[model samples]
Target chain A: MSGRKLIALWLFVVSVVVALMGFWFMATRASMDYWVMAGSLILISITCYLSGVHHYLTTKNRHGRYIILYGSVVLMVAGLSIYIPDVLDLRPWEIYTRIPSDFFFSFFMLIIGILSSYVSFRPFHNFTKEGAQSGAYYIIHLSIIFTLFPLFLIMFNIITRGMGGITWEFLTEDIVSMGEKGGVYPAILGTLAMISLTAIIVLPLGVGTAIYLAEYARKGLAVRVIRTAVNILQGTPSIVHGLFGYAFFVLILFNGQKCLLAGALTLAILTLPIVTRSAEEALNAVPGELRDASLALGATKWQTIKKVVIPPSMPGILTGTVLGIGRAAGETAPIMFTAVYFSGTGTPSGLLRPIMALPYHLLSLYRLVGYRDVEPQAWATALLLLIIVLGINLSAIIVREKYRQRF
Target chain B: MINKVLELLKEEKACQRISLPPGIKAKTSGFSLWYGSTKALKDINIEIKENKVTAIIGPSGCGKSTLLRCFNRMNDTIVSVRTEGNIWLDGYDIYDDVTDCVDIRRKVGMVFQKPNPFPFSIANNIYYGCQVNDMDVEKDEVVERCLKQAALWEEVKDRLSENALSLSGGQQQRLCIARALAIEPEVILMDEPCSALDPIATAKIEDLIHELKKDYTVVIVTHNMQQAARVSDYTAYMYLGELIEFGKTKQIFEKPREENTEKYITGRFG
Candidate 1:
């Protein structure tokens, strides 16, 4: 290797080692002496500076050089403030001392590692198009990691904390002593019944509206008005939908009774816009040439849609509808007012009967946290809700991959 | 004001129709079409002879495809399109208020420029037209007859259950022809059907057109003048939405009638 490349490689290795030490400190919550922290910061900052200079010499691009230098200098100055506070005169020495040592060390190490690696890769790429492309790939991969990290963290936290509460007896029995014990069998059944009814009500209405909008409706005032209404409906809060369902379906239609039908209707209304918009997109994704070919073959407009357009777009429509249903399944606000009771109602008995749903039951368990031993049950209910929603979403993905049409 | 101008042009062009021979399967009389405000076909008057290959040849955007689409009322699919005057199929005005467009389409089949096969088995694609038309027929027999008529039976007979989209471009175009034939329409309209095919595929389609005219009346829109000369019995040359000349293919290619026809045929100007 050339002299410049050799030096860059050595700096990259040192930066990675420092980063690993920083991670160890953060993970174990270890306290470091002021001298050790200061020394590590200085080492990382010098490594960053040399690598940045090496990249600048090779590529003649000042952007990466200035950025790396700026990051390293800021970290070094911050690190020095805790040790020699009067030099920068930015903050009181007491304030700098109060800041946790591990947090500062981890943050400094992360920045230095990122900067060093960027400069290390730059020497290899030399700021060519391929270098820019590789740089873009790295940024995108980092962004994906950032997005998935929080989701996985939440799932891990829930599964670990909730695992103890999910026993066979916990799943099959009714609530005892205000959910201090017993399972959520009725709540599970109630949730299944509500979502199933919601799907039945929403699918035909959403798919029909989608077909009309995509196939028959002209791009005029009526279509524009309908599209705007769907957009507004989709953005409306779930709480408002709950209130409206209480007033309309419960008060007017059911003679002041809270029922499963009322809650399913509200959810159907809540998810209608999602299903309609997605189904319309799926229908529109079908190429116009296919419709033309069908029409040119002496098939009527309706026949052509039924035979040619619907078959290819069915996968997209189902995926969107399943996603909408997944959203409907987890929603607590809309059903709490119109459909679910706190505890009295066991599994659903009739269309007009109120029932205990998982989300509402979890809410009740959360309220009884201090007075009763229900925290584990609350966590278990949350885990179950997550599983149901994720399961529905996974099925949608499977359906899309299985039946996806090319043309 | 546009109607008055069209009426005047109709009178001026009345003498040109006098020389047209018999066996008129479809005819357009002073038929003009506008897409929104843009006129695409203006005062087009031509007669399609029964059981003959009639080719419409002109430069791009000259209303040759528009005139071909008018025979089956296929242009009705475009929302912006507006038409005046009438197109007659088998001596009946197809644009009349009482005429059912579905019924008109059933009697007249169409093939498009690009091979657009439905995402179905090859046999199912052929069976689709019959199913929609409510025709009770032996499925195997109809599939066989139509494929044979399209000259694709031997090539695709074993793969009848395969997706039509799996076929090669030439095979797909021919499959589309077989699908069009399944409904048993009298007149078949082709809109630049071979434009997307290779030279050998184009040759196959041209040969199929020669065999097709013995039974079905064929109205083809083509950009290739040589194909028109080789395949067509009657040729119509149009320019800027108006029919410039209509006569035997030999005369249109040989003797001079209008100056525009001579210029376009001689490559002097489009």
Candidate 2:
């Protein structure tokens, strides 16, 4: 090998070794965090610096890019290892003195290594084609893995941990002894009731608004204002919707009682904008020629919309309905303040009575996670809820595909 | 084939004025239309005789379709469209204050360029107009009659419940004609009805138009000069929102009155 290529190769080897040591020390010797973190930072920084220098010397060599890849990876390992222990902390430095020494050292080493390595990579500002390609791949592949890993891991963990708790008795029986035993049947029933009620309230109004926007109303100031209001309502926090339901529906509308109706109404408000926007898009997709053909046949405006336009756009509207129902099924905050019944004395009956919902029940039981049986019940309830939401989303996609075929 | 027909017609009628036919079914006098600020049809004057196909032949953007739409006040659908004139139908001014827009449209059904079949069973597509217009009639009788009149009954008779969109392009356009006939309107306005069809489909539509003239006053707008000659009895030639020539199909084709008409007829820069 040429002398420059040998140097680049040597730098790459050292970087790999440094990244492995840093990852290992961060995982295994977390208690000896100061030395492990500081040692990793110092070693990886040296590897990054050596790779940069080696890359500069072998600019014309094909292996130059391989050197840049090692330098970038060494820096990535150093930063991740440093930030691992206290990733949840939004402000690490402010609580540095209050935190344990191990956390402080790791955070400190992470910050220093990130700063020094950033400077190390600055020399190759105009990167070679191969280096940028590998660099782009690292960013993208790492992002997909990191983003999806936790979601899949949580789902997998819930399935494995919760499947044992699921039984016919567990699903069909009512809660007993403060949810330490029995099943979540009442919560499941209550959740389904609330979802149906929400669909009942939102579907007609949302579709009406969509039809008016798409078919009747001209593009003007009034329409623009309504569209903006819908967008803002969509972005409004669910907690705010919960609070609104509590204040308006419970206090004024229903004479100060939290019930299934109030909770469903709140969820309807949350999903109304989603339904309206998607349904409007669906209605818009109906061909203009169809409308023309109907009107030309001496059908009135309403008749044209009813007979011709609505039938073709039904699948699209149903897709929007599925999406709205899915969102309503999983919503926690809206139901919490207005409907959830955790420790009620007697059996809750009718729409006016407070009832148990899976999301709020999950929230309540999660505090009792120290108990043995409570943990499994909580996981199983979560699994059930996930399955419901996933099923609705899958059906929405299927309906949308059918709608495309019709057009 | 149309040019040859015009040649024979010229020899038969030697310099005689083309008289107005027996009865004028629909006439537009002092008719003008404006879209927002631009005039689309200017001072249009024309007569549609009864039991005949009146073809409006013009280049694109020459207001042929606009003038045809004016007969039923279909232009009222456009918020920016303004009309100032008289459109007389059956000895009554259709643009009068008492004229119901719905009534005008009911009396005058329309067929479009593309075959739009409502994505429904063929039987339902024919029955919808009658149902929506509140016309109480025997559904099966009307369906069979209209389909036969359009020459589509034999092919679609067995599968009346099948979706109209599932038919071939030619069948769909014929079905649209049958749909127009189901309402049994006095006038039927067709805007480039055969434009989206193949030669065979176009031939079928042209033949149907000939049969329809026995009952309905058919006003058609066509870009193809040959289709105009093949289907229409009276021809109205328009250019740039102005009616250039209004005469029998023979006069318009054989011996032109205006230089502009001759140029346009001979395929000089439309």
Candidate 2 lDDT, tens digit per residue, B61-137? 99999998888877877889888888888866777766677787888989988888888899998998899899989
* lDDT (Cα, 0-100) at A75 in candidate 2: 55
Worst 10 residues of 2 chain A by lDDT: A117-126
Per-residue lDDT of candidate 1, residues B147-265 (tens digit): 99999999999999999989999999999999999999999999899999999999999999999999899999999999999999999999999999999999999995999999999
| Best-performing candidate as measured by TM-score | 1
What are the per-residue Cα lDDT tens digits for candidate 2 across A228-263?
Answer: 999999999999999999999998988988899999
- Model 2 CA deviation exceeding 4 Å by range: A1-151, A345-348, A371-373, A397-405, B1-22
Error of 2 at A344 (Å): 3.7
Q: Please write out the lDDT profile of model 1 over residues A1-407, one tens digit for every residue.
A: 77556755675576667667766677687776555556766765675566567667766766456536654774665466476432243256555534465566566666656555554555455435675576567668867986998899899999998888899988889867767777898999999999999999999999999999999998999999999999999999999999999999999999989999999999999999999999999999999988888888788999999999999999999998899999999988999889988786887999999988988888898998898778999999889889989999999999999999987
Chain A TM-scores in order = 0.82, 0.73
Clashing pairs in 2: none
List CA RMSD, all candidates: 6.3, 10.4
Question: lDDT per model, in order?
Answer: 0.85, 0.80
